[model samples]
Target: MTLPADITERLARLALPSQAVIDGAHVDALSGETFDNVSPRDGQLLNKVAACQKEDVALAVFAARTAFEDGRWRDQGPRAKKAVLFRLAELMERDADELALLESLDVGKPISDARNVDIPLAINTCRWYAEALDKVYGEVGASPVDRLSYAVHEPLGVIGAIVPWNFPLHMAMWKVAPALAMGNSVVLKPAEESPLTALKLGALALEAGLPAGVLNVVPGFGAVTGEALALSMDVDMIAFTGSGPVGRKLMEYSARSNLKRISLELGGKSPQIVFADCPDLEAAAQAAAWGVFYNQGEVCTAASRLLVEASIKEAFVERVAEVAKGMKVGDPLDPSTQFGAMVSERQMNTALGYIAIAGSQGARRVLGGGQVLKETGGFYVEPTIFDRLQPSHALAREEVFGPVLGVMSFTTEDEAIALANDTVYGLAAGLWTSDVNRALRGARRLKAGLVWVNGWDACDITMPFGGFKQSGFGRDRSLHALHKYADLKSVSVTLR
Candidate 1:
């Protein structure tokens, strides 16, 4: 696994964003405090990042409010806002390689994925929203003959956007792009584990000619900076992507403050079902195996649960296990590496702990078990798969958020749907079958926000992304996402 010379050179001179970006400028925390940003890849010191606390959040919120109220951005002509967003997208494209490297290093994800998927998608998302800014139209409602009624979409000002470590810049853009496109000011709080990309994005937004105080970046732990942003009375909305506990806390914080609108994209323990009549067994096997192992299974919609028909259970698991065994688990910076380190040693331990609990809960390990590549000082785990587990098993119910897959067999379509919907999460699910009737029926019966008939994660940015039930609410992609950052105002004019 040779590192690219370009990547090597960039790594040698990596300059991390060590301060929060507020009012379109980089600044230290009001308390001048900082924390170590250690690389999970090798436990090396990446940099010392500013630890923004309550006061820093207050400053960011005030800045955002001022920008929103004064119409610095909110009152911009649609085309003007579009031009700035388009410029930001162009800048992201210009620095694509650098952004990819930052994400790969910060999140311990494969460089190939960062370069090919995350950063590119983030840039596309920005461009997509920029192109959409001038295209969105309001509606005219029918009213009595004496009056004319129309509804207009207004920007929800002062958004507190909190993104997770797994996707980092991608998730931030999911919120920021839409919020900014709608002419709202934003205070972005990147996950403490991964903040470099968000800070850089803020800088790029300013470089793209966005007004000062339109977008602010605060990097720190969730307890202080995140909570402060969530509890800010001035903030109009909170668009968050993370865990259920944190989402609930955000709601509570909103309740305690301004009753700000909360849009949550909590992680999910999704399922992938395979019937014996699958169109392509090999493809299904690949989907089941890689879907769970990709990004070290850090994805919120990871298909961690694989439901196979009873008749094909044994053979399918073998096929999936072979795919899992072939995964190249190594340094994320290496081009050929498919599986990378966990975001931190703590996350690695969490996966290991879940594996231990799965063993105790009567699940038989089919492939992979413990940590690997320990000599490299990185937190790498083998792609693990477990079968012979009941739906009641803890591994089957919980989100391990690691390179671990649990297998179960269902004799009937009814049972498969039942098992798939048993979890508290309803983010995404998939099924493979040649029978269109069963596929359609199962898709309808399955409880999830997004469902794929013959593939895993088959959709793109054009589709709405989010979850149902306890997995949380609020769509994050497509034209629907812009609605999250807007308010509907109805007006009626009486005819003379």
Candidate 2:
């Protein structure tokens, strides 16, 4: 896993955000423990990051609780919170390059994608909540003129946000922005695989004039640090984005602790259906190719299943195969690289194992079915695709969470919807059709939280993002997110 001379030099000069941020300062783990953060680019050691555990979580929760109870943040007027958040957004924009670099190095995403997509989106999220903080309005209950009854939204106090590694900073902001904008303190427990930006974000929060203990970051394994946060009684709410098992565990922990509110955004085995009368076959083919393959297919709402009409299935598959083949998979640091390595060797192995399982189950792999760039000792997987995959097959049913897509053919629209809804996931789905009636029908009939017609992943931060059914409850973005972070209380007053 060797890097080029320039990249090596740049990495050496780059300051890794390795320490945990607690009470507005960077500190080593109380246990003095550290873990090796290896680069997926070349399997090389990037740095030894603080392995914050239960003790760290306690400290962070205490900080968050103190800030909440003391009214250091929760009592701040909306304008104060807005100013702090706006400054934080400015800081993020200022450090965009370094943030993008840390994201790429830590998450194995391309630098360009980090800079163009994740970083900008995170900044926008911060600004969006900041700009909208003062605009949030409460309700007025209908009552007699002699009496007044009104409901006001109040902060939920200490919030524990546990975000995943795939898009660490971006996902963290999705929870952090609104939580903070609602005048609540936050304890951020970032995924172990990519903790750099979260740690940096905590520091940036302090720099943005957020009161001490308003934002704290602890980085460690899920079993240790994450468990502590979930089980903490001081936490008022747990906003989590990860796997289903973890989400269930969070719920159990919530009940076992203070019955604190828990919100989860989990996995999806989203299907992209294309009718024979698709308005643009080429456009649909491109969407099918990038929807699952982008971000190494680590997205929870990735269109992992392609359900197409039998008449154009072969042609559509060929176009997708061409796009996958042409995509360059190499170093994440390279701006030109379209695809990058897996976040870890373990993830690469999981994807490969899934590919093998699909083959054994009789699914035909139309494109890449194995690993590439093995000589570099890096974790890399070629964009893989399977054809004519049966709906009951494991590839089509399970969430691979990788760059592997299973294409299934359908004769009718009803069959396509059935094939799409057969899975346990109901996160997101997409359909491409030229018929306006069919488009409306499919968009309504699809069993998903978000459905895109004639496109894939076409929505943005302006829309609510989450899943239905087993994909977990609660949402991450849009104005709905603000309501999730606050509690409504009705006050009645009588005037003489």
Candidate with top TM-score is 1
Of candidate 1, the 10-residue stretch with the lowest lDDT total is 1-10
Clashing pairs in 2: 1-42
- Candidate 1 Cα deviation (angstroms), residue 135: 2.3
lDDT of 2 by residue, 1-496 (tens): 4556766676677899889989888999999999999888789888899999899999999988898899988888888888999999999999998899899999789888998999999999999999988888988889899999999999999999999999999999999999999989999998889989998998898889999998999999999999999999899999999999999999999999999999999999999999999999999999999999999989998999999999998988999999999999988888788899899999999999999999999999899988998887788999999997987788988888899999999999899999989989999999999899998998898889999998888888889998889998898889999999999999999978
lDDT of each: 0.93, 0.92
Cα lDDT tens digits, model 1, 1-496, are 3688987999888778889999878999999999999887888889999999999999999999999999999999988998999999999999988999899889899999999999999999999999988777898988999999999999988999999999999999999999999999999999999999999999899999999999999999999999999888899999999999999999999999999999999979899999999999999999998889999999999999999999999999999999988889889999888999999999999999999999999899999989988887888889999999888898998889999999999999898999999999999999999999998898899899999989999988899999999999999999999988999999999999
Which portions of model 1 show Cα errors greater than 4 Å?
none
Error of 1 at 367 (Å): 1.0
Q: RMSD, each candidate, Å?
A: 1.0, 1.3
TM-score, cand. 2: 0.98
Q: What value does the lDDT take at residue 278 in candidate 1?
A: 97
Local lDDT at 291 for model 1: 88
